[model samples]
Target: MKTWIVLLASTLVLPAHASNHITDSEKKTPLQVETIAQFNGIPWGLVLLDNQTAIVAIKNGAAYRVNLATRMTTRLTGLPNVDNRGQGGLLDVAIPPIANTQNWLYFTYAKPTSEGSTTALGRAKLDNNHLSDWQDVLVTNAVVSGTKHYGSRITFDNKGHVFFSIGDRGERDLAQDLSNHAGSIIRLRLDGSVPSDNPFVSDANSRNEIWSYGHRNPQGIYYDAKTDTLWSNEHGPRGGDEINLIRAGGNYGWPIVSYGKEYWGPSIGDGAEKEGIDNPEVVFTPSIAPGSLLRYKSSNASDWNGDFISPALALRHLNRVSINQDGEYTETRYLEDLNERLRSIAQDDTGVLYIGTDSGKLLKVTLNGS
Candidate 1:
């Protein structure tokens, strides 16, 4: 095992520009980082079963139970066949918060279809080293030609609903279409049933599972039960990656309105803002390429309580954003020295953080003074 002790100094505060009375404060936290385990493939999803154990999902359609103390891994079985093409494969895994449903493990992966590949949600019970009662809960209607935009991640709300994201599947106009599940966040009951209170449940033309529309590729979705807030971070073409406060029935303008420029050096969409579209709480220009999101609540490290953290792929850092009561944000970037494409993040009961990197390294980060 290798270890590194680093002190991270907070960066300059950037104005959120959404609301007033945003305060800027500087924080200096000493970190103890340890490379707990290594893999041959990217660690796409990570969830802690307990303080000493965790379940990790690899991008190559493999899952493992990892021991945090000994750095040992046990392979898990019974996952459905996933299309490991382009950016599609085994993705996020999450455990529901409710006590009655806590035994079931939820997952999102790229399911291969006759037409192509689409994002799918599934659930299973962990029986020793293997999965039992494996079932595909929802096979999204997002099949298209390319595999680059399967923006899938799982999170559960305080209510009995599960939410997951799907990218535009490389088709830009599909984000605005209500008939398909592409480029949208989907909400469903724990048993794969559609909730009647969903935004488009009554619209025959729209998919009943849709919670919100017009998202490009939201790779990360986190629901904070304490604040009752849903947060998402998505990728943009060249610039304009966004961190949005997700709202039910709200439209987040994507192709029709974007702060990003086209790959061929042209402005995208009608403009950056439109009347009915909801604006993002934070926008990262030049694309940090956030792969996952977490609303960190640390009892051990009180300074980090209620902060939002995401792993940056393009910039290779741990991105942290502090949101004040007035909805203002102060941003900070950490761990650039590691130079790994951080993909997923999770926190333990004692407030220790586990980060999954694209380089197949599982990192454990702890606040030194805590």
Candidate 2:
């Protein structure tokens, strides 16, 4: 359930630019943003297939194949009917490498269950317009008793294997449980099997699919093009949102070690800076509630060169960081004044940028300098 527990600061009017525009109430900037297409439901995922084509996944259990040049959108068929209640709904989507040869697409959805709903990640092919040859790739192991915190985001590595993020399922202790997949990073074969090289393949205290553990609800999972390192943005309780560098068998320490406290305003473990718990590369004391991640290589916009971009939903700003060698980052730039919940970020092969908003709008941000 969406709560009005926030009061965003008003944005100041900036010079006319492609990244932002001044609005009246200032409550919604990108809501009226111009784009080639729009979303029919709560947007969760976005990706650029190429220069002219892009894909957007919505909570309405639909994914839209978009053409940027023509300003047209085509709804891809054969998506699952999701349990769209509370925060449980259709989630992350990705076009895997096999999609090139087989038109295969991977997606995750909230599968209805008697206890509640368990988040499931599945892979299937798009047979000319229909989803054909469907296969169940993976399902979260923990029992879901609540409709909140179903963290289901998917990505692929250089080896072409799949790495998915499963939320803690609102049961904090489950994150520390090795038998459960909840609140951990799961790495799997493209055909949906646990790989042999996994950290806990034969461990009695861990699930084979788990790459890392102790995460609350991570929304962004991206692989760096050069380093091949994975980066994720995890949502903290109230504040304490984090940008983490994920490693094989690393423990992120959610309820055990956190930058923020419990939602009821109690202390969450030791603190932000602890010894055993891996600290975040950067922490958002007042949470920005990051939803999507896009690593820029070449210039996506006029001002932004190659950098890691995280769109802030609760903060309504885009924070850009310069990646350094020692696995650290410096705040390089910030795209401010967009007062809307940024849902996703994508840049086509040609380098044009597109930002999707939760308010049913798609924004095309470019450079206006001549």
**For each predicted model, how many residue pairs clash, with residues at least 3 apart or on different chains?**
0, 0
**Backbone clashes (count) for model 1:** 0
Which residue pairs clash in candidate 1? none
Deviation (Å) of 304 in candidate 2: 3.8
lDDT score, candidate 1: 0.88
lDDT of 2 by residue, 1-370 (tens): 1111222223323221112322334342221234566677867777766777777788878888888778788887877777788767878878774435477778888878777787788877766456777777876776576877787778888786888887888888888788898898889888888889899998976788899998998888887757788888878888888878899988898878887778789778776666767767767656778877767655334435666677778867666655455544444223454467886787665445677788877777643321
Lowest summed-lDDT stretch of 10 residues in model 2? 1-10
Question: After TM-score superposition, what is the CA distance of residue 289 in candidate 2 from its true location, in Å?
Answer: 0.2
Q: TM-score of model 1 relative to the true fold?
A: 0.95
Angstrom error at residue 39, model 1: 0.9
Q: Model 1: which ten-residue window has the lowest total lDDT?
A: 17-26
By TM-score, how accurate is candidate 2?
Answer: 0.85
Please, what is the whole-model Cα lDDT of each candidate in the order they appear?
Answer: 0.88, 0.72
Question: Which candidate tops lDDT?
Answer: 1
Give one digit per residue, the lDDT tens place, for model 1 in 1-370.
5565564544645466332122223545567888989998999999998899999999999999999998999999999999999999999999888887747999999999888989999999998888999989999999986888899899999899999999999998999999999999999999999999999999999999999999999989999898898889999889889999999998999899988889899899787889999988887777889989998776674767888899999989898889776666877778877889999999987888999999899999987755
Best by TM-score: 1
